[model samples]
Target: MTFQLRVLLVLAPILLPLRSSISQESAPTTTPLHRIVPQTPAELRELFRYTATRLPIVSAHRGGAGPGYPENCIATFEHTLAETFSMLEIDPRMTRDGHVVLHHDATLDRTTTGTGKLADKTLAELKQLRLKDSEGNVTDYQIPTLDEALRWAKGKTILVLDQKDVPLETRVGKISQHKAEAYAMMIVGSFKDVVACHRLNRDIMMEVMIPSHAKVQAFDALGVPWQNVIAFLGHVPPTDPSLYEAVHQKGASTMIGTSRNLDRVFHRRVRDAPDSLRRDYQMILGRGADVIETDLPREIGRLLYAPLSKSPLGHRLLRVE
Candidate 1:
């Protein structure tokens, strides 16, 4: 048999079982407050694909920031996972000594007790500093290495690694080293990055930012299979109705970011009004978003899952929500 035929034969067993699991069933009334991390690459891919289309797959922006739990910390991730099967969006940065660490800002001054650039500190030095919660209050939590975070997420929650200061090769290497290809996904900003990372490890899933239909087409031309990609539609409400359709046609899911919209629309106009929040969510879902990424996953998840009569809007925004 030829090489391609052999590859297909190998993949059939993994792909065949997924069809039955991926369904349009409604989400359970009570979301289990526990983590269910994918143990294998096939299981991870199946879960990722299923969740993307299943609607209301909450991705905790910066590890579900709240009162005591700080963003991107292990404790924060665990806290969010305990509430729902969340996808934690984390930033991976490299220290001066080359250890990959979980942190959002380039400087540790904002979230941690350390001062100056994070690149200036070694992993040991970075670890000694305590993390601060969302309210800027000091906590006992310390900065965790990317490896530590990935290992912790195993079989618990999905992890989306925001490529910040780290190189694609380095990040992919770490994921491979930890055997986290299933549990972790890297956010690639360009088509070149997508191709490069895929070439490095075809099993490594990617979250791509394809802002327009033209951009989506351009990415399609790169020949990376859509099954391995999750297209990001940006922070603003999408103007093109065809964008989501195009992505869906390619067998990929489109992610709509509500982090900016929460500040721009909900906070400014609604001011915590339940009715307005539901309307804004409906507007985004109406535009064909497969997944909603928000800073407030808990609140968004609640709104998405709220009963039709209780919700300001009568119709359900997401099928599973």
Candidate 2:
């Protein structure tokens, strides 16, 4: 036989077993991933494809809480497992003891009852401090380690590690060791950091987070389809298209918002205020964004995915909603 046919013959047996092993049980629900693990890369890729059709999927900015779970707490991460959100945004940092832990802000004062730098605290000390909600009310939730968060991702939604202040190598290393691709998978991290991490481990999904409209070129060249672009509303007289276009032309998807990635914006920032946050959303949607991360993901899905709009993912979301 020819070389190509011979190679195909050699690989067929190895591939058949993987296809057979995909035990897809339709997005597990027991406390957010109580069942399912051991997924193949092919199965994971297919799942990602189907979910993208439901674009603008809810991504709990900090793993959405249930009734009373504080934001970014383990409870919230578990709750997210039950939601339809295709992804979750989580922040991870290192403790003084060199253990990986989860928290958003670089400092510890705003989130926990503790009053010092997070890096200054040992894992035991960090765990001693209870986490607080946005209202500054303390709850029973203690800080969680990265291992806990990964456990929540097991055969559930994707994890988008928003480790803005952590070293890329460290974050990527932990995710790889877990073999998260067998469960949910991650974008690994934001724009600048992910570039280095991708070169080190190209199999990992990379996401870019932008504060300003610069640096889309370097991020797009990395060949990843998803890049989380931060959407803003200030500094223009309205009708600004430069930044979104810059990212879209690079073949990477843009995550726009009237504010940051949440798709909510300040009403005061829009010059004419004619552009509702949704209008601003449509602008980037027009740019062919592969995904839109918004707090109002349901509304965006309704409008963009409306029957008449021809949005690729809209139909499915509308039916579900």
RMSD of each: 11.3, 12.8
Best by lDDT: 1
lDDT (CA) for every model shown? 0.72, 0.51
Q: What is the TM-score of each predicted model, taking all chains together?
A: 0.81, 0.63
User: How many residue pairs clash in each candidate at the backbone level?
Assistant: 2, 2
Candidate 2: deviation at residue 98, Å?
A: 0.9
After superposition of all CA atoms, the RMSD between model 1 and the true structure is 11.3
Model 1 bad stretches (over 4 Å): 1-32, 48-53, 263-272, 305-321
lDDT of 2 by residue, 87-172 (tens): 56677888898998888877888878998789898999998899886467788889988888787666655677765556777776
lDDT of 1 at 52: 29
Most TM-score-accurate candidate? 1
Model 1 clash tally? 2
